[model samples]
Target: MWIHKSRNPNQNFKRGGCMFSIFLWEEKDVQRGLFKMTCFSAVEPKQLGVILKDMQRIKDGYAWFLDGCVFCIQPFQNQSRYSLKGYRIFFNTSIETGMYLYDITLGLLGGQISGIECVIKCPSKKSSDWISGLRSDTSFQMTDPRGLFNKNGCGIIVVNDTVILQMRNRNKLKVYEALKKIDSIREELLSSVEYDLFSCSKEAG
Candidate 1:
């Protein structure tokens, strides 16, 4: 079980009559780290080919579109083994690419999409530390990943190698703001932990 410190309730924001919420997940035992963001969207399974074709048409020589992303439809159980579920359009490699996909996805689908789920992976640090650090630093409620999504449509999850930050809100600005907040928290954690480690080494020397 994960125990978390509470984040300020006032941190939840709403603007232009749209629903906006954010959450951070916390675990009991963990280490510290840095983060890079990746993103994906859930869409109608049938729209997979259409969206892929459109993206290809406007790829504009951006090789990353082909090399750094994935497009696939999910398989579901329906009476047979081949029933298709929804599609997952994923983007990795860089924040710029993820944001670009977010922009065009909105343009193409409008409010039809809930929002993109951004995964912040910390390759050089322990996910447990990141979760613990976020739990202490942010006012976002500490909840299980499922609760985070069921309640606010936005939340964080710590997997084996990464911390996934998911937001389902359709407002682009709010989504960006939430990502920035997470980034800020990550930087603070890195700085504080690094300073502590350095001081410990000096003392040992």
Candidate 2:
């Protein structure tokens, strides 16, 4: 079962309602601690490569992926949230190795987008940095944003661990072609990924 991670209550922020997320996880074994979560809208492929080099935890398998389109929604008007329409694919990896590869691909795609929001490996509970980041950005919402995986009706949860993330019911085949390309070079690019998760607090502190 996936668990939802909650954000600090003290922080304050204001943002629009448009939101969506695409996450890939090993549905067979949640306890193995191997999964990849990502968000997107429109991103430049080239700039993304530069950002990946800076994130060490993702390189080391200690952080989950987070990305989004910073301008998708506006605070003043109630706009319909964006959806990954027309694509349908169950997010089941053939094996644990597929999970690792998908996670890496998700992380890489994250940087291609405008907002590479935040990265928190599962089981992480709290972080002052995350709290401060929420308060610092007026674009980010304090509550859950509407759309897929946001069944709770709240805006994006900064710290998410619950089954809400497992996305057992929904998947996108639009990424299938991308996943195939990623898988082709997977062996040469990702030989072995450590499934261990590092505490967000320990590193944030």
The lDDT values for all models are 0.40, 0.28
Clashing pairs in 1: 7-139, 8-139, 30-128, 30-129, 31-129
> What TM value does model 2 have?
0.21
Residues 1-205 of candidate 1 have per-residue lDDT tens digits of 1112243222332221322222111221123322223223334434545654543321111111233232212212122224323223333323454455656653344423334444444435465665565566456566763213221344666565455555554335365555555545545545766776788799999
Among these predicted structures, which one has the highest lDDT? 1
Q: Poorest 10 consecutive residues of model 1 by lDDT? A: 56-65
TM-score, candidate number 1: 0.42
- C-alpha RMSD of candidate 2: 18.2
Estimate, for each residue in 24-101, the C-alpha lDDT of model 2 and write its tens digit.
Answer: 232222322222323442333233345434332211121222321011111112223463212111222333433344
User: How well does candidate 1 score on lDDT at residue 125?
Assistant: 47
lDDT of 2: 0.28
Candidate 1, which segments miss by more than 4 Å at Cα? 1-63, 66-86, 93-97, 109-111, 135-141, 144-154, 170-205
